[model samples]
Target: METIQVVFLTVLVFFVIVTIHEWGHYYFAKRAGILVREFAIGFGPKLFSIKRGETRFTLRLVPAGGFVRMAGEDPEIVDVSEGQTVALRVKDDKVTRIYLDRLDERSGVVRGEVTAIDLERDLFVSLDLDGEIERFRVHPQALMISKGKETQIAPIDRQFGSKSVGARAMAIFAGPMMNFILAFVLFAVCVQMAGVPKENPDKLFVGSITDKSPASGSDLKRGDTIFAVNGTPIGGNFKLMVDIINKSKDTAVKFDIIREGVKHSVNITPAFDKESQSYRVGISADPQTRPATFMETFTIAGKQMKVWTINIFEGFKKIITAQFKLSDIGGPVRTAQYTSQFAAEGIDKLTFWTAILSLYLGIFNLMPIPALDGSRLIFIGIEAVRGRPVNPNRESMVHFIGFALIMLLMVVVTFNDILLLVRGEQ
Candidate 1:
């Protein structure tokens, strides 16, 4: 049953995130007249499939990723100007390329030249003034073109760049916007399930201070009750620790502590342990666990949701900046190990952490990296600037590269997760 819970949570979160992402594209693409070939979850071999109109929907074996495959995702749009020949223009540059086939032939190749590029649209809009335009439907290779007697190869246009910039931008923005919508909806629902908490006075007392730690130098001693740090009141250990770590990078904190029924104050610089990605002022708590108010429970959960969202973004930033190594990343295996560890701590702890994890998943999916909703937004932003869509071929290539990089990162993280699980440390 424990294992079942982990699987269920993982699948539930993954499905929610991926569905929102793909649906974003599916919604916008249909509105834009783009033909979607497949809306799929997972990768590798297909586990199940359903055909609806022109779209083939499938659940694949892998649960880690998904895609929305559209025909216009390419730079070249299909044309049948002549019964035996098909022609296409470079979507952005307006250079036309032609392909020829015998009356009985099913496919043929065309050659042409193109110049002038649109980075935002990924289109090559104009060719050399005197260049020839050759269009093709077949013969993907061996296309040629020239200007002023100087010849150049003309590449086929994928329809992605051919669409209006607004259409292209909509397609790109759709995924991230969907993620945000999911997050907002989930957050609001969680809010309704849990109400906001009232501000409670600090009752958590420091039971120990590590020797030679920053807290020791700052006048913090055993049995000191911490009321606030750097002017931020501490309602509990989670809030106190989070506030400290957030400021650990550069700020020096002043602690308002009470000992022996007398209030005293101290200043300490929090130190960062790069490995844990957390901060410490060298003090330990006797785990002053408080009973949640009927209202505090909901508020506490909602606040945690907010904290987890911030943490997820910070983690992503650190990973990108190399402060967090890829080897430190965790996958489902690590997540399960953590779930198991917390489950043994009782339902409250497990439930709290689960809420945090859910929020993490919700926020992370909204990022704009390639193969991510966030990354799709970047493309959308570009289209908005260029007043036209990005070239389909270029867009596909960029995403392909991003996908490869993401896969590599995932492999590393998964290895790390498995290692942590084996050691029973996650």
Candidate 2:
């Protein structure tokens, strides 16, 4: 049951992040008038699908990452070779429907051998019928039925490549943008849920104690001010207090406190924390928190976001510069481990972890790596400089290679994560 809970929670956390991230792309793509073919969650076999508007939303078997499939985002498009037979439905001299494999025997459908076509520009199909060539106009919203699957033909105007560089960049960038939005919203929610923390200076007071920790069973109470530790005056210095306790090495330390104006002393032992390899009593200093005003909440969240972004970028820089080896990286296994660990603490702790993870995702996706949003932005940047788009095939090949390298790294990281788990290293 515990393992099942861990797995479920792990998938749920990833699912939430991926869903929000992909929805960002889908939202912007639709707004830009691009034909969104499918918005799918996960990979592999399809579990079910719900289509709305021009997009077919699908939930696949895997409970991992998802994608927003915009038309013309791919290097390959619909192509018809000469001397091939296909059925078409024409209305007002325009080809409204093209049947590739199904509905060929249906009435009012004209079947002919294809000689030439222009699906993107002129939207016309020329066919050789009984030794004479006849051309028919293709509708802007023509439906192409192939193997019983119907997909609306994407004209040049409705394709992703047709959009301006800014619009295309926004659609591509929206995935990471959404992740940042989610992080901010989660940060705001968590901040509001747990009162906003205000730093208190010139005072070392107890605010709370960790459950099952030494301080939780001690004589320390909330609002009690620490005056000294083991005969040394702390003088409202929290770090000094911590240093004294850590140096104690699981030995009982004397704590002098003033509780409600009454001076008292208590003996508390700092237990060893295997995770940090340090001694800890698990007591927190007074945060001096109060209910944040609506306007103040967002301000605090924004400031917190600044710190998260800095740390994320610094970590990426370290990894990119090879300060640490790639094999030292963690993967989904490590994430699952942390998820289970934090969830065991409480919902609030888990929520804080989720927000951090979301922020990391948002920032990581913006790195200039192939197969990432940042890489797409780089291509767009080049297009802006050159006054035209890059070759779609070349761009696709670069991304494909990048994706392969990423998968290779993932395998290595997963192996390392399991090894670390067994060896008990963080």
Kindly list the per-residue Cα lDDT of model 1 for residues 314-334, writing each as its tens digit.
Answer: 888887888975557787656
Residue pairs of candidate 2 with colliding backbone atoms: none
Cα RMSD for predicted model 1:
14.7
Per-residue lDDT tens digits for candidate 2, residues 1-426, read 276776677677888888999999999999999999999997769999988877899999755467788899894345567888888999988999988775546679988899998888889999888889999999988888776778888889889999999999999999999889989988888788777555554557885578789988988886788888999997667888889999997799998989988999989999999998999998887544568889888987898799988988888889879899755677888887788777665566677788888888888888889988889899999999999898999999999998779777777888899988889776
Per-candidate clash tally: 37, 0
Q: Model 1, residue 75: displacement in angstroms?
A: 6.4
Instruction: Tell me the TM-score of each prediction against the true structure.
Output: 0.52, 0.80
- RMSD of every candidate to native, in Å, equals 14.7, 4.9
Query: In terms of lDDT, which candidate is strongest?
Result: 2
After superposing candidate 1, which stretches have Cα over 4 Å from the reference? 75-162, 198-309, 336-391
Model 1, residue 103: distance off in Å is 16
Candidate 2 regions exceeding 4 Å error are 1-9, 61-64, 90-94, 102-108, 126-135, 197-268, 272-279, 282-288, 325-327, 422-426
